[model samples]
Target: MDNDISKLKIERQPLLATPRKSRHLGRWIGIGIAVLVVTGIGFSMANRPTSVQLTSVTQAYPSQAITVLNATGYVVAQRKASIASKATGRLEWLGVREGSTVKAGELIARLENADLKANVAQAAANIDVARARLQEARAELQDASRAHDRALDLKQQNFISNAELDQVKARLDRAKATVAGAQSGIGAAAAGTEAAKVAVANTEIRAPFDGVILTKNANVGDVVAPFSSSAEAKAAVVTMADLSTLEVEADVAESSIGKVKVGMPCEIQLDALPDVRLKGVVASQVPSVDRSKATVMFKIRFVEKSDRVLPEMSAKVAFLERELTSHERTPKMAVNPAALAGDGKEATLWQIVDGKLKRVPVQRGEKLGDLQTISGPVKIGDKVISKPTDHLKEGGAAVVAEK
Candidate 1:
């Protein structure tokens, strides 16, 4: 019976069975695991927000759009003077030093005036002596005139000799001449006194205009002189500048000169005071051009001068095509230039709305410094992404980078 069961195809019921379907099932399970891993990775990637940096749309002006060029120059005072004494003498006193403000005709320094004062005293004494001599001459002339009249009367009455009358007349003439000589001496002495007073007045160095002292070139006991070349002589007692006359001398390139005009609006920046922006206008343009630097000089007068503005300080200026109003100085709408995505009259900026990046279109205008003028749905306070990723699309969430 065992031999017959073995012969029957069963041979014996095996403890384990090897099926072809098992190999295929194992392969199918591996494929399913791989698919789950790929799906999970994709889901994580799709949910991640794009990292971005953001800037604001700001208020700009009309002239900011018309700015044609920018150039660097220096702050210069159109009315600056070196205060010095016209008369050469040792400096006796200095009233103003560096940073001292003075008014027009204010005394800034004084020179040694001992000799001038002595000369004035001498002239006064001489005039007194001359005046005393004139009084004596007048008395003598009066006496002489009386004697001449008496002699003339006696001669007429034939009680005196003719020779006596002639002698008295001659005495009267000599007395008159003496009186005239004394009067002339007094006039000459008075003129000497006047000249001495003027000399003393010249010893004082005065401010020609209202200004601030920039330097104190001379000190007490220093010899001050005009056109002084001697090492011991100080030519300028103090250097002063009119703060009100402060202007910027900008060097505009020849190629860009055509865009600048007289009275064109400008923005001025000083290296020393970088945070404060100054408003100015193109006051004048130099007739000549600098060949060595290929630049034309443009003089810009500040609309409002600050006390911090100094002479010969480094500066930068932006020359616009037209003048701007006081309200225009403050921008109406502006944006960073980096936010612009395309090149044309219209600029494209990606804006974040409800945490999603959205493409915004704005009409581009002239630039003010680094800020660009724009007009669109975006207003002054709206924030826009500065730089966005290429893969970032409309309605995609963007995360502001902490960095």
Candidate 2:
């Protein structure tokens, strides 16, 4: 009975082992099938035909007149200056400081002028003394004249000797010489007084023109000089600029200089004020050219006054080909360059009409940069291919993609 029971247990073990091996084999087969199905789907998707979608933009006829040459420059005052002293002296008073609007002949600064003032006073006293001497000499001349007349009368009457008359005449001549000398001395002294007054005036600096004081180089107690190289000599007491007489100094390329002329209309755009466009004109073309830069400098003057404008503000100048006619001044629609096929003589563009690429003929005008002016039956809002592919033909079906 024990042997039979053992045999049955061995049989049960074989049955359990067979079932477990079969279950493991089934799991591997299921995994292999899943991988094969996934690979097949991936291959199928990749092989499928894909519809090519081309990127495109529309084109329209351009209308506005465009300027040819554009150059950058800086706004500068034509009559700007750095005012300095003509004579060396310690600055005693500064009448004007930075940002001070001054008129022509306005007093700007003054130097220590006590010495000059004293010299003028001394010169005036000398002139008075010389005048007194002149008066004394004139009185002597009158006396001499009376004596000479008496001498002549004596000679005529034969009451006095000829030698005595001659002696009286010599004395009268001597007095005349003294009077002339005194008169000359008075004239010299008067000239000295006038010169001293000029020196005193030089100590007081005045504005050369109507302007705004942009800088003040000297303060009270600073030593100012006539732009010399002494350690203590300050060159300029004040630096001013005429804001009303502002101009733009532009360096135009030598090649473009011929297109520019005096009085040509220009549109100025300041870098500081990008939104503000100022009207101006070509004031003058500098006669000399900068050889190193291969450019010609031009002067442009603004037509309108602007308080925002300042000296040395960077600017861009657009020199128009011709003054924009009243009709051309308004903004107009424009088209892309690729829309025009061929060499711009006769051009064609593809437009989608009824889900088809319809070829349209256009007459082309002058090219404005990368854009070209076109006249066609199409209107401004009409859609046209920017750059049509060679596969695109007349009456071909087009799948319009979202732009």
Candidate 3:
């Protein structure tokens, strides 16, 4: 019976069970896979580009560092005039127009003077008539004198009576009086001619000084009157200005007026010619402040004059601490101080090249308004990282942040 029960019971199957070596191999494979995934994630995070902000190294003028004050104004001519005629007449001839250059005493216009010319001619004829009468009177006086001498001799020789000699003397005296009257008439006629000539000269209009005509206030056939209120009568012949006397008239705040002084050096920039920086000096300041604007007006004269500059152009003026030297006038390389990564003595900035960060060594210089002058391999327009942080390794890729 024991032998039959042993035959019905099931035996343990060792072949079907898993082996220890195989389980150990499977566990090690799972562990290896997990380690690989963790390593891959770490490597990807390290290789990813870091986002950064950048600023460009630019060329800046040295004058920006020393600028004390800035003001805006307009160009104006110091010597300007509205030319008008002193005498009233029709403008028969106009010899100049707008933009014409004229010299002092140059004839610019003429008035109708036919009647005046006739008066001069008549006065001249009167003088000639008076002189002819004087000549006749002198001839009579000479004849009377000869006759009187003959009479005196005859009376001395007892050939004539005393009453006859007296009559001859009276005739001679009468001729002398007639000659004096003729001479007086000639002098009066000469004076009349001079007065007529002066009247004729008044018809011509001439320039008062050297200047360029800015506008033609009167044209040919326009009547010019010195004090006329009628619409048809022109008061001015032209408006003119001396271009050489061009100056900048700037207004400064009354509180800041103390910083300005006569003869102080300044830089002028015209809105018309923005890129051109002109040299100037403070010429004068108005004695009183403007009550409405609460500002003081001052004049700035150009050190170097340009023909292109004109009156009434908008301009900006910078009052400098001192005149810039020849070298200082030129622009120099500059960068924002925040981009620098080291102390003043040993400075370094990250410059971007080929989409990667590069550490460039530079020497620090004077501090401009918001930038620091630097001498390095960087040129104008080169982009550099501002406020660099750790993990931004040299030769590492970087992406620029949107402005």
Candidate 4:
């Protein structure tokens, strides 16, 4: 039995010799391996993407390159007037409205003139009555002349006394005076008739010049006074302007007014029609400066007439150094100057393609305002890095910085 027990003790393998490895050592090593894996993941995340500011390629007008001065203005008519009647009366009939075209001496409206017409007719009738009276007096004068002739015959024959012959002569003289008075009355009546006709004509409103009606100030049944300050009575029947004399009135800063001059070429862009650019020339500069705005008025005339251009439209004018050529009038793709990575002929651009960096070669051209024109494989709307740094590399992941 003792020998069997000794063999069992020996089978314990010498108490398993004090273990060289601690039980917690393996746990600590596992923790260290996990920490290394997490650190590697964080390092990879930090290096994956670089934040950058980007700008898009855009189409720019060639005129921007040559623009010497820019100003805001409004379309105005050079020949504008408020059409009113000479006489005060109610507006009985209106033949025009806004946008109606009128010619010189054309009737545009009429006033209530029934009383004037009657006055004209009465004056004409008075003239006729005076003419009839003059005819009656002439007949009487003829009778008196015959009597006087007979009286003279009698006096020569001594058939009547001298006193009787004198009385007959007096009667003939009276008849002559009556005839002269009647003739004078006819002349006065004719003059009155002409005066009445003039009064009647004044009731008819006629256009003094060719123009287009811009506003209807007085409608039918409204009182129109020639010279009135009453609010109830309109001083003008309508407002009109000569569309052929349309012009742009721009306000140039007094400081920059020296840059502008008469006959300087200009390009006009109307806010109503943004795409259409109208050719123009500076017609005049107001000699006086506006005190409130500190600006000088510049009048510009259109070289080409456009039916689309209307009065009172907002406009932008670019006073060019020179007229744009046909090719330069077209729009070209452009970019900011900072987007180019290098100087001189070796300039390059960092383009962002699908969140990755791509190096593109570019040939710089003209300078438009603060932007630089370029010709390259890039198209409009392509996003490119602006102000690239040494850390930016081709084929690297990129992240757009929030503006």
Better of 1 and 3 by TM-score: 1
Over the full model, what C-alpha lDDT does candidate 3 score relative to the true structure?
A: 0.89
Judge candidate 4 against the unseen true structure and give its global Cα lDDT, from 0 to 1.
0.90
Clashes of 2: 0
RMSD of each: 8.4, 9.3, 9.6, 6.4
Clashes of each: 8, 0, 0, 0
Q: Candidate 3: which stretches are off by over 4 Å? A: 1-60, 147-181, 331-367, 370-403
Q: What lDDT does model 2 reach? A: 0.80
Identify the runs in model 2 with alpha carbons over 4 angstroms from their true place.
Answer: 1-12, 15-65, 325-403
What tens-digit string does per-residue lDDT give for candidate 2 at 32-147?
99999999999886554322233233342112246768899999998888888788899999988788999999999999999899999999999888889888988988998899
Worst 10 residues of 1 by lDDT: 1-10
Clashing pairs in model 3, backbone N/Cα/C closer than 3 A: none
How well is each residue in 1-403 modelled by candidate 3, as lDDT tens digits?
A: 3567768878887678788899999999999999999999999999988889988898777888788899999999999888777778898999988889999888888888899899999999999999999999999999999999999999999999999999999999999999999999999999999989887778787887898888998888999887666678998888888999999999999999989999999989899986678899999999998999999999999997888898899999999999978887777799989888878667988966788889999999888788889998888888889888867789998888888
**Every candidate's lDDT:** 0.87, 0.80, 0.89, 0.90
10 residues in a row with least lDDT, candidate 4: 6-15
Tens-digit lDDT track of model 4 for 18-118: 45577678889999999999999999986789889988988778888778899999999989998888888899999998999999999999999999999
Give model 1's TM-score versus the native structure.
Answer: 0.69
TM-score of each: 0.69, 0.69, 0.65, 0.76
Candidate 3, 9: how far from true, in Å? 56
| TM-score, structure 4 vs. true | 0.76
